[model samples]
Target: MLARMTGALRFSPAEIAGFAILAAVVFLVLPLALDTFRLNLAGKYLTYAFVAVGLVLCWGAGGILSLGQGVFFGLGGYCMAMFLKLEASTPAATRIQSTPGIPDFMDWNQLTALPWWWEPFHSLAFSLVAVVAVPVALAWIIGLAMFRRRVGGVYFAIITQSLAAILTILVIGQQGFTGGVNGITDLRTLLGWDIRTDAAKEILYFVNGALLFACLLLARFILKSKLGRVLVAMRDQEDRVRFSGYDVAQFKMFIFCAGAAFAGVGGAMFTLQVGFMSPTLVGIVPSIEMVIFCAVGGRLSILGAVYGTLLVNWAKTTFSESFPELWLLGLGALFIGVVMAFPNGLAGLYADHVEPRIRALLAWLGVRGAMPAPVAGGAAREMAPARSVAGGRQSGRSLQARGGASPEPGP
Candidate 1:
């Protein structure tokens, strides 16, 4: 049992190397190369990566495509933003406002008392829990309604997109309660710590990186477990799995909720790093862009999501600065090119093209057992062992091991 558990939890050496390389790039290289401003921008990009990683598990692994992830992200950000805004809206701080101790927007909109729903956010603990719980709760409801009924594919995607649009309109319409079009801005501190400083931003960046790794590891564990296999099977053969007596709807709901939880956490971190949560980020456009991030990063690869987010955002910043009018067109073209030319995205490219060369080089260098079997998108493929015929390896081998050429054993 212990050995079985260990094997289940084990990661391939290539995955370990990937993790180390990513850590170095995020924690060491980027900080050394970029100034504080650029580093902060990268930090912001990392927050979106949270959503992309979730998409990998939900869309890539489970075949559940949600285009309304921004709703969860925005909810999480709003939870944190409410806390920060309240802390900044002390009676003394907002003394000049018509209603002291209330958010400026509330006071401007003639709200004399804090809304009952917003009251709970004043407690940091409650706010923290709400950041994740709120989104998951919403996901749970949606999953129950749709997944249980087997409403999925493009129809489900359209529903989620509609949710994003609805949420954006609700937030904008309820200005007094939600801070409206401007969002919950002017956020100053977090539990008495000023979050607007460069030093503070740097600290938050490292914290975000640490949290990202934690999420990645959690995702890895999920994908490596039996549950992960079930998800993949359900993705490829949902009716088969359902007919085999598994609770397909339950599994789908769980993974969807998990994705929402991850997105919520990202939204909270985004609020801290950017010091604001706006409707612009919680709308249809941003939601669609989030999907593009996952696709560009290799939706099947968790780590690739982070790299993709950084790459796309960096390109957006660079191109928009130069050709503001054509940036949208370029972005559309880039997405089209990626979808058409590289359906599996960067991770697929690396696995198909780059990993083999690296393995050959290691083999040439007489490195024995240093390079473990390669994984595609951080998950080990299910390969069959070579069959023995006449006391020798032959016949009945898997497609990956045809012609007596056995694939490398996975960890």
Candidate 2:
């Protein structure tokens, strides 16, 4: 049982190395290298990495492509935003407004009082729960409705994309409640502690990094389990898995909800790090872009998703600053190029080309366990030339025994 448990929890050496390197970069290197401002930007980018990691599990491993991850992200962000917004809108602070206790946007729109639904968010604990639960609940509903009916592939993708568009429109239309296109801005505090300070931002960045690592470990655990194998089987052969007595729809629903939960956590972190949550993030374009981040990082690679999110967002910031009008086009072209030239994304390239060379170098340097065990038939192939030489020597001995002239061995 101990052996089985150990096996179940075992991660590959490469994966272990990846986790360590990622931790070092996020926790140690970036904090030391970047200023608070740049670090905060990185924290924002890491928020999106949550969604990308979910996509790696949902789309990469399970073959369930969702383009409405932004919806979950928005829900989580809004949940946290509501809490912060409420905390900021103290009766004393908003005494000049039409509604003394309501949010400023509600006051601007001539709102009379805080809505009933917003009451629960007043509690930090409840708000945090909602941040995860709301998105997961939505995912559960969607998965039950669609997966039960066997809806998937391009159709599912389109449905998710449509949901993103619809949610964006709804948020904009409900301006009085949802803050419209301006989003929930000017967030001030968490538990009465001002969050806008540079020191606060730095703390939040580290917190975000820690949360991200937790998510990474959770994802790693899921992928390493039997459930992960089942997910892969379902991805490649759904009917086979279903026929083998597994409830395919339940598995799909579970993974879909898990992805939504991850997105929700990311969204909440985004709000804390960026000081706002907006309808712009809950739209079709951002949703698709999130998918692109996953794809570019190698949808199958959890760590790669983080790297991809950082790289793409970095490029986006750089390009948008220099060529505001052409950045979108450049992004499209980058995605196209990646899809065409590197279908498996950066992770695939590393695995096929880079990792092998690194392993070879390590092995040459006499590092133990640097090289993987040889594959079946590999040993036989390697020994073929030696076997041929041995056969030649045996033939020479036989000829000498038969009284024939022995062949001279040449150097």
lDDT of each: 0.87, 0.86
Candidate 2 lDDT by residue in tens digits, 240-330 = 7877899999999999999999999999999999999999999999999999998898777888888889999999999899999999999
Per-model TM against the reference: 0.91, 0.89
Off by over 4 Å in 2: 1-6, 371-411
Model 1 spans with C-alpha error above 4 angstroms: 1-6, 374-377, 380-411
- Top model number, TM-score: 1
- The global Cα lDDT (0 to 1) of model 2 is 0.86
**lDDT of candidate 1 over 270-321, digit per residue (tens):** 9999999999999999998999998898877888888888899999999999
Error of 2 at 267 (Å): 0.3
lDDT of 2 at 156: 100
